[model samples]
Target: MKTDVEELTPTRVKLTVEVPFDELKPNLDKAYKEISQQVRIKGFRPGKVPAPLIDKYVGRGAVLQEAVNDALPELYGRAVEETEIFVLGQPDVEVTELDDGNQFAFTAEVDIRPKFEVPDYDGLEVVVDDAEVTDEQVDETIGNLRERFASLTTAERPVEDGDFATIDLVARIGGEEIEDASTSGYSYEVGSKSAIEGLDDALVGLSAGEEKTFTGTLVGGERAGEEAEITVTVQSVKVKNLPELDDEFAQLASEFDTIDELRDDVRARLGRQVKLQQLSEARDKALEALLEKIDIPLPDKVVEEEISRRNQQLEQQLQMAGMSKEDYLKDEEKSEEEFDKDVADAARLAVKGGFVLDQLAVQEELGVENEELSEYVVTQAMQMGVQPQQLAEYLTQNNQLPAIVSEVLRSKALNLVVEHVTVKDESGNEIDVDAVQRELNGETGETVAADDTDAADEAGVDEADTAEVDTAEAAEAAEPAEAAADAPAATAETAADEAPAAEPKNEGAKDA
Candidate 1:
């Protein structure tokens, strides 16, 4: 067999392969054997029919076609191996020649990963905001904790913001009621504005048993976005009573014996959260800097596909939220043209970033270990609210394992880049990204005091910190893959030859 490659473009190639009759014998024999089991000869048992006899019965052209169909995938793969081109998507294949007993030839044109230099990523610099925890932030965190343990009491007064009001509400169009939009005895915060429009404003200044009717638009249901008459009758108004911030309050809310200890724990937790946020920002800025330094040409087809996918996903989410594109654009304050351009730009960046990181992974000899993959799967399952085994089974059954591997490899490559790059805070102070990561992972020599351990844990630091860290880690780990999710399927195992399937051996034979 002989194979030749033609450079159609830097990102694409055309391969022409020629094979002599001798190399075609194996596929021909297999095709004949397969055909024998399907066709019944008058005197011979199934699988015992001679090839020549079957050829006489089922034309040699049909047999040759069958053999060629069976051989093309393997032959194409061999040509690819010999040429050693980084093919991207599936190839466009055509059988160019078939000299009955002498030679066979075909051509395949495919997109490929363009060859480019991955520049030195070390010394790349980016600036992130300082991870400084302020007293106000700590107070706010503690205040939220206090609110969690607050008590409710009936107040004989008008409804007001920050007060929980128990109300009965009804919605009607021209005095005809909309059942789904109406509820009885629902409790809502006056300032939350989470319910229908005009509901919050109407609730204020209303006492118990006092009712007022206002016009508001229905946000969901068959009459969504349509205006209707809303009547809200307040059953009662209750004010939240927060416990006094004292040693007794600390003991009641947490295991801490004093308010000072509780405040200290809150400050420390806020500090960790801020640092994690800083790390996340740094990853984004570092990646942006790296991309700016590199030049990579994205395939137009991949970009277009990604844009379409993103649009489809957005449309699905908006549909589930009962919103139209016009409503979404209005809410986002973007015109259709601007939104379209944004989608296209984002798609191109996603494609280019995938390509760059992929090359970087190769250059750095990065590999994904089983443990790493398992951790990734588990983390993703947690975010998706599914069991790890169920998610793994779904991914495996859908042939998505390669995509997952690619994602992990890209994540490792990004991490390597982040480690090498110089990241500083906005105040020009050089920040230690590694130290922050260690602290988040609880690897630092900092341990909760034995007596304060349960108190601190009960104060909500460990749980909230764990959740925040998992979120940050998941976002950083999955960002690349999520961005490139719609890029061309580039894994070798999934690069199907796209050759045509075999034809029926004969008219009277079962389909092969």
Candidate 2:
């Protein structure tokens, strides 16, 4: 057997392989055995029929076809290995030559990873906002906490701002009632400014049983931008009764005994959350900047495949939402051509980013640790309101765990770059690494070491126990003779932190 390789592009290769008659004989014999088992001769037992007898009955062409089918994958794999091509997708195999006692020749075209020089990432300067937790922010956080525990009470007066109202609404175009423009006993909040322009104003000053008519344009829906006469009849009004911000209220609302303690805790939590958001944004900016400096040509086939997958997923999502493709496109304000153009750009970005991150991971020798992956999976499961084992089963059933691991590793590589980079503020001042990390992790402006004993204790897990389950599984699968071989590694925790481990089922729900 022999193989020749030709470079078609930076990320594509064409391989021509030739298998001599000696190499083809084994496949021919195996093919004959397989076919002999499927056919029944008058006096011959199943699979006991001779090759020549089966060939005489089934035709020589059928035998050759079966042999070729069985041999293609093995031959292609050998050719790929011999040529040292890191194929990305399934190859397009074309048999070029096949003759009796001669040579079996074929060509395979495939996409491969493009080799390129990585830019210097260490000490790369990036800008991030200074972590600043203000009194106003703390106050807002407290107000939100209070709102969460607020009680709704019926009111006997006209609807006002911040008050909830039950109303009957009817929309008409040129005084003709629209078929889908009426709702009874719809509960709306005055000043929410969500339903339509002038809706809140119309609800205000209207008591129960009072009716008012107004005109507004449908901001969305089939008749978007069309003016419609709307009649609103107020059925009831209600107001939220907020608890007092006192020690007694704190006792009822949380485990804290006093309002001061609750307020302090809320402030700390809010500060940490804000810091985490800033860190995430900063990391994104830094990554985007670094990618801009790098040159990576994505394989066309990879981009096309990704685009097809994304489009399919989008179609599935639309169908599940009881929406047609046309309706979805209309809602996005895009034509088919426009949507395709956007999808192409997105696919290119995805492929390029993946390639660049993978290269970086290789260069940095960064990997996902066992404990980190386990912790990640466990954390994700908890967030999804499922047990860790359940989440694992779900991921396995969906065959998404590997993809998740890949994503995790990519993020870890990015974090490695970020760790060495110099982050500055708008004023050109070097940002404090501890302060930035606190903001990024939403750690209440507190800088804690990754191996913080107190945090581990709080989480009910010691450092050793945190090893990722996937890594452990891999190690157990390794044989003693092959134990010396490098074991499979789990995905990085930082990557898991950046993206939700599992895709969210509902946009409104917290990610797992």
> Candidate 2: which stretches are off by over 4 Å?
170-181, 196-198, 213-230, 307-347, 365-369, 394-405, 427-512
Clashing residue pairs found in predicted model 1: none
Give candidate 1 regions above 4 Å deviation.
40-44, 53-62, 312-328, 378-397, 442-512
TM-score of model 2 (CA atoms)? 0.76
lDDT of 1 by residue, 143-229 (tens): 877766776678999998878888998899988999988988887777877778889899999999999999999987889889999
lDDT of each structure?
0.74, 0.68
TM-scores, one per candidate: 0.79, 0.76
lDDT of 2 by residue, 1-512 (tens): 98998999988889989889778788889988998899999899998999889879998889888999998988887786677555676789899998877888999998787877569877678887665778898888777667667766778898889887879999999878875767898778688776768898898899999999999987656787799999999988878777889999899878999999998887766655555555565666667677788877778767787778667767777656655677677767889998888878766666666666667766766565556556666756544556676776776687555555555566676777677777777678786665556544353232232322223213333344333355455323432112211111112221211111222221221111
When superposed on Cα atoms, how far off is each prediction in RMSD?
12.7, 6.9
